[model samples]
Target: YAASKGAAQGLAAGIQAGKGVAIKSLEKLGVKYFWTGMSSEILKMNHYKEVANLTDVIYTAKLKVCDELTYDNFVNMCEQFDIKIGVYTEEVKNALLPKYAVPNALNRIVSEAETTAKEVFEAESTRIAAEITEQQTAVINATYSSWQIAITASVIAIVVIVLIMVIIYLILRYRRKKKMKKKLQYIKLLEE
Candidate 1:
């Protein structure tokens, strides 16, 4: 259970970090320029709001329960954010930026966001798997050591029992021989 929670937290951290990176990329590509630009009043209000709301969405999503469903939901949110960001970029580019630079810039922003997400997912999942494997290996080694100790103890116990049995047999045989010798001496005395 602890491991599961840890995994969830790790995933959430990765996703949140990825979201921050994506947002930075958007900012670097002049996303905020469109927001505060002089012609911004003419633009569809929802486009900017959607882009702005992304930070809130990501922040809230990260705080949710860390589970598979939560992770899936995050991925879906990222995809949606990607789409919304694309639309916003397109709207801004057509309204403000020159044609020659629009396509590559737009594509780059979206692709960077997607690539960041994929990288985060891969890196975090791999780290988690490695952690689990390391833990499992430790457990296995501990169990193997316990088995070795148990076997060693059993062997020592068996050896001690065998030694005690041998000692008892030797004592019994000596006592029986002594008794026989005494009987013979008595018989010899009777004969005399």
Candidate 2:
């Protein structure tokens, strides 16, 4: 009987440890899955096709088993410990039943995870949106600046061309007037 009890204890301990590990694993997977989903949404919104595709792989593999795993672990541990302690009272059953307690604990864990994920997603989304907007604004400003420079240079070139034409016209008009004066003098001298 003592050996049997020792074996039972060992088995219970192993089961508890295994369940604990599973619960932790499930919790991590659930959180990571939630975060990946949020990040994927953001990536899609930002048009990051390649990166979003990569995240999709993780999304497919990540499992959301937090509730089921936690519930099972809670019930099994409660039963095992109650058995070990030889507590089979109606009061314990009524108070610490799986149906009553698992839901509450599960709800708390789910709620906490959701709240934290939402806060993180909101903050990250806002930051990324602002960054993209800033980058777009910078690109637009650069394009506008280049256009302005080109227009200014074109206007300057046009003005310089117009001034050169005006200068050439003035030089041609002055030479023609001097040539006419010489012709008039020669005619007056010949007439005299």
Candidate 3:
């Protein structure tokens, strides 16, 4: 930790020195500007793919629902749309389920339990949806937390194993030294 801190401090100092030199050079050149590494692609693409997929689910749910949608709405949406919300849900369902003489759109509507936009979401279904959402959130959070705890436990276990090995090595070394001492003493006594 100390070494890491020292390295960070050294880097900070180097950056500060570079900044001062850069400022002087810019002043001499009669220029003053800086460009940042943040681009639209970086902001849009990086660290957002997971959130992006989630957003698509949420957006689709929004279009299907006139009222507020719950987490269960998203879950139901996944089940209703494309058999599993695939990139080719419409195409696949159109080829398969639509062949049943029942349109895929009608099946989705029936599955969604809505006769019309006025009957969009049920109160009971909403309550159940909220509960399901809460449970799903808990599960995802628990999974991530469990993994972190497991990693921590693994690190502790490794440290303890190393400590045990070092302790065993020290004990063996001490015993060997005592045995050598006793052997030397017996040889000296015989010589005497």
Model 3: lDDT of residue 46: 25
lDDT of model 2, residue 53? 34
lDDT ranking, high to low: 1, 2, 3
Per-candidate Cα lDDT values, in order, are 0.54, 0.48, 0.44
Candidate 3, residue 112: Cα displacement in angstroms equals: 29
Candidate 3's TM-score reads 0.29
Every model's TM-score: 0.51, 0.48, 0.29
Q: Give candidate 3's error at residue 20 in angstroms.
A: 66
State the lDDT of candidate 2 residue by residue for 137-162, as single tens digits.
89999999999999999999999999
Model 3 agreement with the true structure over 43-162: per-residue lDDT tens digits = 343221122233233333334552344577554543354443232344444444323322333234223322221122233344455666677789899999999999999999999999
**Which candidate number would show the highest TM-score if scored against the true structure?**
1
Model 3: colliding residue pairs: none
**How well does candidate 2 match the true structure in TM-score terms?**
0.48
Ranking by TM-score: 1, 2, 3
- Global local distance difference test of model 3: 0.44
lDDT of 1: 0.54
